[model samples]
Target: MDWDREARTGLPEAVFCAGKTPAQIDAILAEARAAGRRVLLTRLDPARRDALAAKEGLDYDAASATAILGGPAPARPGRIAIVTGGLADLPAATEALRTLAFCGFAGELVADVGVAGLWRLLERIDAIREVDVVIAVAGMEGAIFSVLAGLVTAPIIALPVSFGSGVSAGGRLALDAALGSCAPGLVAVNIDNGFGAAQAAIRMLSPRGGTAQNAGPS
Candidate 1:
């Protein structure tokens, strides 16, 4: 664990569980409990989640592939929005949602609103605009980020997911398009990094003026 991460950086420590063994994850969880620290474990598999569920104080969300130790912070209205291009994008969207939940922020989801059917997204324009920040999750061309940027004044956090298919090449094109977007108030995070997107939104909505100097909520 990064002891100074919360105080110095204003972010909690999280475990990446994709490559770690069950025993290793358990050890980390034990450490977190021992230190009275809240931790999030990302990319966790269902088997591991189930196995660890027996442990005291561990909650797991299968859709997001995330597990929480020491309970999530209480959720409050934070005026955050999460929109996805298609159903295939829900996995990524779920990750952001779980992260937001852990940080005590509430968010709404606008699903299956890809640019191909612009009308779907157009229908939700007014609702999306009411939020302080928008998280656009897409995988194919990642055009949603730029499109949303042109419409909403709220800052957009572009989150790209990997399709693992031809040409798309695990979301490289989407990532590239998001980074090169011409629209204002659009920021891009790493491909499939839903947690990163959530953290960015939390910072943007932070009353502390979006600087690490102001520590986040406990």
Candidate 2:
């Protein structure tokens, strides 16, 4: 994949930390960072982050369940907001945010703002309106994206997280919700596919899908 498109678009490469062994995740991260790129690791285990302590310029977020590569956030020409439901959704949400930051967009996030508390989302209306695009990182019903699409002018990238238990077939509900979104602006990504969502968002924001030199995953 053209990971560098994110760089051209001013976004970062993302790591999927689920299912894979810690060593695999770490190695993948090494490749990305070695190319002078920052990364966002999602669904990473606590132990995994601990093992990576030897690495400098790393920021770990237990709440967000993410690890951002070293260095300051990248600057963006347009605004992209990432909204998540509960604290549990933060890990995936942060992954999206880091992707945007790595890709070159100054991204923003609104955490714990699911439909249960519409007011919380309403309060951020100003911030939502200011952004050019939005990435909704959620599990469960994934209604957050629909709500955002209804309320904001910006396009929304809906991510169905695979965090729910029960007969509730792994993010299927979230995916269905996104697919059923009546709002014209809602776009859905794969289940727990923050990398895909971020790449798509950045491509739309970037000029002409960015240059080939900036293509491919870093």
Candidate 3:
């Protein structure tokens, strides 16, 4: 479980629940409890979440398929803005938001602002610009990532969502676009990896002194 990870890297170990059986998850949770640790669980589907419903202090969000054990830590010092290209991208954006919350950071969601309707994003530009970091979630051509990067001074973390048809299927098109973006200094994580994007933002916002308080939940 890498119990010292928060002390070593300013980031605690998180459990990825996908492909894990109920018994295995129970064991992991039991171990965490025994160690007096707080843990975040990602990719926990509704069925699996239901299976673990008896777990004490389990805070589950079905939309993002994420769960928190031992509750979230106190809020940290950082402002994050999660922008989605469209309503279809909300799941990925929600994951990022949940990750930030679990890590004791506050973030806001700016939804349905795809370039297809540029006015939507333009109207909300002011609010988004106020954040320390921006997470852009999009599918299809993923023009939103580049557009937001160009518009905002904050670091842009492109999170490609798997929501589209044809060439955009499986989020590959959006992933390629993010990787190939002409926007200077724009960074990208794996397709649909909202948790990774949140962690990256946390690292960017973490105190330079490497204090354990800034490290995510213990």
Q: Please tell me which predicted candidate would have the highest TM-score against the true structure.
A: 3
> On residues 92-167, what C-alpha lDDT tens digit does candidate 3 reach at each position?
8998998899889888999999999999999999999999999999999999999999998999999999999999
TM-scores of all candidate predictions against the true structure:
0.90, 0.75, 0.94
Error of 3 at 120 (Å): 0.7
| Model 1 Cα lDDT, one tens digit per residue, 1-218 | 67556565556668989988888888888877788888888999898776663467778788889878777786655788999999998888999988888888877999999999999999999999999899999998899999999998898999999964687779998999899999976899999999999988887776554324555544
Compare candidates 1 and 2 on lDDT and give the better one: 1
**Total backbone clashes of candidate 2, pairs 3 or more residues apart or in separate chains:** 20
Candidate 1 regions with alpha-carbon error over 4 angstroms: 50-54, 209-218
Q: Rank the candidates by TM-score, best first.
A: 3, 1, 2
Q: How far is 68's C-alpha from truth in model 3 (Å)?
A: 0.4
Top candidate, metric lDDT:
3
| Superior by TM-score: candidate 2 or candidate 3 | 3
Superposition TM-score, candidate 1 onto the true structure: 0.90
Ranking by lDDT: 3, 1, 2
